[model samples]
Target: MTYLVNDSADFVDESIEGFVAANADLVRRVHGGVVRATRTPPGQVAVVIGGGSGHYPAFAGLVGQGLAHGAAMGNIFASPSAQQIYSVARAAASDAGVLLSFGNYAGDVLNFGIAEERLKADGIPCRCFAVTDDVCSGPADKAGERRGIAGDLTVFRAAALAAAEGKSLDAVHDFASHANDRTRSFGVAFSGCTLPGASEPLFTVPESRMGVGMGIHGEQGIEEVDMPRADDLADMLVDRLLGERPNDNQRAASPRVGVMLNGLGSVKYEELFVLYRRVSQRLEQAGLTVVQPEVGELVTSFEMAGVSLTLFWLDDALEAAWTAPATTPAYRRGGVPLEGEPRDADDFAAIHEQAAPPSSEASRSDAAGVLAVIEAIQARIEAEADDLGKLDAISGDGDHGIGMTTGTRAALAAARRAVEKGCGAGTVLTRAGDAWANEAGGTSGALWGLGLRCVGTAIGDSDSVAAAAVVQGIRDATDAIMRLGGADIGDKTMLDAMQPFANALAEQVEAGTCLREAWRHAAKHSEQAAAATAALKPRKGRAKNHSEKSVGHADPGAVSFAMIVASTATTLESIHEDVT
Candidate 1:
């Protein structure tokens, strides 16, 4: 049974309670679920925002100095009731009046509309602005039907500045609407997410695949496709966004662009950077100058592994507001540039040029063992691609299954060629790592390649790997992974399995066990250790938000590594028996 808190009914209030408790200096809970910034000066145009509870920083966290003046918090994945919106509006209003900003959704529209009536009846001047920037959410022919994604940030910034400048409600509303019209967003999700206090996720996605146009609430997407490399995925998202460029044929000659790389909760900052590099490269290649690009977790779904790309066609007015100094917990500007061109071309070229070449002195027997291990791992990954993808959907980018399968297949082919050419085991492993790194091109590729090289280095010139050699090799590989990724044991990573396996092998080797027997013991211990990771809260990696939920799921990397080791040990044993 899935472990989850069944507190959905109280999720909204409880979350707000925590939010207010932590941000008491910046904001105060007024009436209903409305939170208003204590720093909002009177007589300024008040900007009020509202949405569901899960998308923090959207409708609630944005309420602070230089941000939203007030926010109406809603239930998890549900729109706030009209009464809540009305309460927020009344609390935030001044002589200049209040401007309501929110994402475009049916429930939000219905509820906010009712609130608008109540606010007007109470003699509060109010206007509404809805953000509908997701190009993938709606058909091109009916752009109005698109849902809002990350573009809400741009809309809120414009409205808040207009209000801060003491403009009337009408002026702030107009500016917000204009920002919404100019902005466009597209997103892809590898997995789905569970609402607070829910036993199951709201939806499910297949393994080795991604759902384009997925909504923040686990809504179905336009289509699912085989998971591609970061560059390929970035290209697809950027191309779609560029295709929807507002027909400025008659309006402006050179349109500056503002890009926001939004993480959907589960993706790590490092992985996001990998994706951002591709995005900036694509934008530069398209001849569109990015005035300023925002990266990080500005918008998110609760631990959902996805990313959204937002492009705002900037004018002088909007650019001024965007570039204006602002401070918040999650969003910031003017510290260090998060995205930029490569600083050193020479360093970049050196790193890229370190590809491994085919080996020169591998024997047939050694080659066979390596090939067997590669084939077994590849076959397993292909077979479980869907399952891995599904599991990842719950807490990470769902492409683990597909990414591993594709990479293993490529690595296997490289290994086979190296073996056929009589290369040594080390050379074969090096070539395989290089092939996987170049062809697969993602977090997993770099990791798997590093592991292969580690193993190859430990094996050195051994005709047959002994239990001690294998354990040392795995230790070396683990060290490489930790060095490259900065992930340690209990981080819900493959190291959970690897550490235990290495220890078990070392113990068995010390006890005078045969290589095959030691492997059996290690694989068994590794499986238990992998399963044990389900109880660990993720301290690192992309699934940091849902660290709690990731407790019960085995680390995908660990499981795969165990399988490869077990297969190799068994194959080597069989070869020994044949020789005897």
Candidate 2:
């Protein structure tokens, strides 16, 4: 089915805009995301959850006084950037720190990790708990490496409810982590979904087949098999989930559980009810009492033809939270006490109107040069986005190309404005990085923003530009990326290319090479490093789910970095030749 949208490129922003417009009573717009319209108590911990835009109730639809305090939405199938996460957290800040929660995908980890660091640096303590509940993604021994699907709801609800109960940050994190450990989910898809503007679905299943154990980001199932009858599907899901109850709960006698039969997208409500009927009968037969069973689309991929079942093993505390009142746009439970009377929020829109500081004439001229580099990078990103997305689709959610294209175009627009305004190198880069992070909203976007800002800080607006300065900037950016992303050189991230480039550039420049010549030499090392990633197993990001299948495919981040650097080096060399 074709989606009704005004502009394909404006889909995410417009969707968020419409969400805020319709849910004004429960949520309000913030700088980089949305927050609850009603304020929380002064000392209450804020639970903020987020990810890509395609998952509905998991993010914006759940922002309310008793559920998530805020949500940072990103482009479809991409993780929200660090800047977006931080802004949403800041809008929801209180005397108590923030508890940032999301699915345990690679992009979410990187972006949320950066936001947590920034929040702490700004005098607000923060903690992150990533949900890992997809049973088919990994074995119980390695659950931490699994991808999160519908289980994001159970974990987020537990944390948000604990926070609403005035629990400490530690308690919030504990409860969320506890919920993740206790929750298990399994899913099967009959067909894939198409993005808003896409002509076809991300992937397809045979007419007589079904995709088993799938992710929420339009990712195809791990294994395909013959389609089964509705009752057979229910039995299969219940048996598998019950077979591997959390280690601690497996020993409990008559363990009560909260059952959720979720529809991904295209699966109708009546269909879910039919499945739930069989599921409930099986649980009863197994001597497990179902507490507060739910059958609905709590989280979804865009029009995906699939369904998933989540079993949240309930204890005294978990059951209490499960029944706790929650009020949001798409979900509402018992009457939750409202924090405050709904109020007008006319003052929150000032976050986008920041002014860049003045800089020297030479620095402003250099900023114009940086703008050219950004344009070249944007062009390359646009040309290769589809290929990059295809690489990511092999194991990831398949939005890398879109994220990169959107982020680079945004960065170029910002840098051009800064250059015209007579800004310095640092100011130009800072503005561009912020724009990139906010627009792209993914793991690569957040890290790239951090790296750019680090480089900008090292190359001060007041300093003289030289080979030493550029080397220092590259080294600084590399370190910041490592610190923020928690990935070493072999983790198959953008850092794989970044580290080698910095090293080569530093060595060449120290030995009296000009900036352009040194840059060309460094770009060679970056390209080689990017290509070498094909042989390594991914330990981080979405690719980790299919660790073995990811072998022989160079990471998209590493590949993009090599292209940007190589292109920039060529532009610089041509400029040098003209000047001579």
Candidate 3:
């Protein structure tokens, strides 16, 4: 993989140097890998934070006027050396002394523990708190051992505020520790990520499957499960969080929750917001008052396809600290402060607009044959999902199988319901398209949805989809796919299969061949076209990275497209024979 660095060993230093250079006015690099903001308030208790690199904004990014007094930096995914941690502790001390805050990881604990002992020996007065917020990382009985994820932000913010408020060093430590206790996080990854200049990813999940409880460093998760819709994923995460509902049975008190929808890295903002909408809805349903929900890359791995959820049980002290105005390079609350606003009113409507509307047409069975064919296609994909994912993994993000399976399953379910309702092929396809859009939720989803919608438009009310109509449908679907995905035939995508199928169907129609014969011809052409994609280097889409490795492997998207066309062809041939 291409990397933006001079050397893997120097990656951390280069990045921190650049960071300090950019924010030199607000931050100054100290002796022990610590970046201290020059404008720390006088005589205040100092707040020090540290963590591994790559998860930016956690340790260094939080250093500013109202946040950390100083931050210690570690190498990517590796804990800072003990000497580095001690240096940061020495630099961040005030008359009230310093409080060291960092995530709960083995390396971090060992290094930071050494730093704490060294500092105490020198009579500098230092204490330490660890953020153990990731619920997925450890069992309930051992939650204290769980690695901290995005919850580091909440812990740091609380500690910073306590220090800024003239609290004693011990008090600041207590507040930060309290914040850590209240926070919990869980994460899922669709794909693994590579370290800078590394040729291989740290770990990988099969296509159409998610790694539940995945850590930030590409660690194998607790389980692998079939990927679900955005709403379902959000629900699962929220349920796990709410299931451990903090005991608030004391004295008539309402529970307040603070949510952070954090992107691991390289996940588009649009996809993140889709998840945020669902997360907010689930939290509301759980009867928790969500205050000032945060969404974005608060903490991130290096371009990993994953997201983590952090929920903090809010209290007066923590809530006050959370709402306190703070500025950092990655996190800032510059807008109207979230405090004093009616807590019940969540402004998520703008974000929730991405969920497409359902089909207006009622379901029906006039398209039973078409529905059967779609189901067959769906079954084929489900059966071959693992194989396809393996193929795609050679050159792509290994999601083609999952994307195809997800889109087809949704399409089949909708089509089956339409058939039961006696709907025509057009209505079935249109409804299936709508369902695909609502369930799949990605660039591939939009493409498949458009393709189905266009095909539906071409086959409107036809008792049998004729060869000419099938040709037109393929043309329409191809056009829509192109418009949505901007991929062409040689891009090693489904377009390779689709374009050939459409052209062959048109030729058969011109020659006045039987629908069965035309379909057979189209399916044959589609299979060949799909195989041909193996020879064509990918110029776009996720497969661009392994274009050479992909040369001998059929494009998963193309292979699936051919399979669908073949299934449809076979089903239509049976129906034609019955009619004759």
Model number with the top TM-score: 2
lDDT of 1 by residue, 1-580 (tens): 1234446555667777777888765566764454444434556788888777777667677776566777886656555655567667776676677888788774565456556755786787877777899997767778776787789989988987787777877888988988888899999898887876667776767888999888887665788999989999999999999999887552455567899998988887898899999999988888777887988887788878899999998888888777765544445554422111222322112212233344333334666677777787788777878887877766765757766776788899989887776766666676677566434434565567667866776765435544566567778877766765567887887788888888888898778877777778888888788778777777654466456667678776667766666666656543231111
Q: Write the per-residue lDDT of candidate 2 for residues 537-571, one digit (tens) a residue.
A: 99876676578887899998999999999988866
Q: Which residue pairs clash in candidate 1? A: 191-393, 207-389, 362-423, 362-424, 534-551, 534-552
Residues 528-553, candidate 3: write the lDDT tens digits: 99989878988765356457888878
Model 2: lDDT to the true structure: 0.84
Among residues 3 or more apart in sequence or in different chains, the pairs in candidate 2 whose N, CA or C atoms overlap within 3 Å are: 106-541
**lDDT agreement with native, every candidate:** 0.72, 0.84, 0.73
lDDT accuracy of residue 237 in candidate 1: 90
Point out where model 1 deviates above 4 Å: 1-6, 249-254, 334-580
Question: Which candidate order results from sorting by lDDT in descending order?
Answer: 2, 3, 1
- TM-scores, each model vs. reference: 0.56, 0.92, 0.57
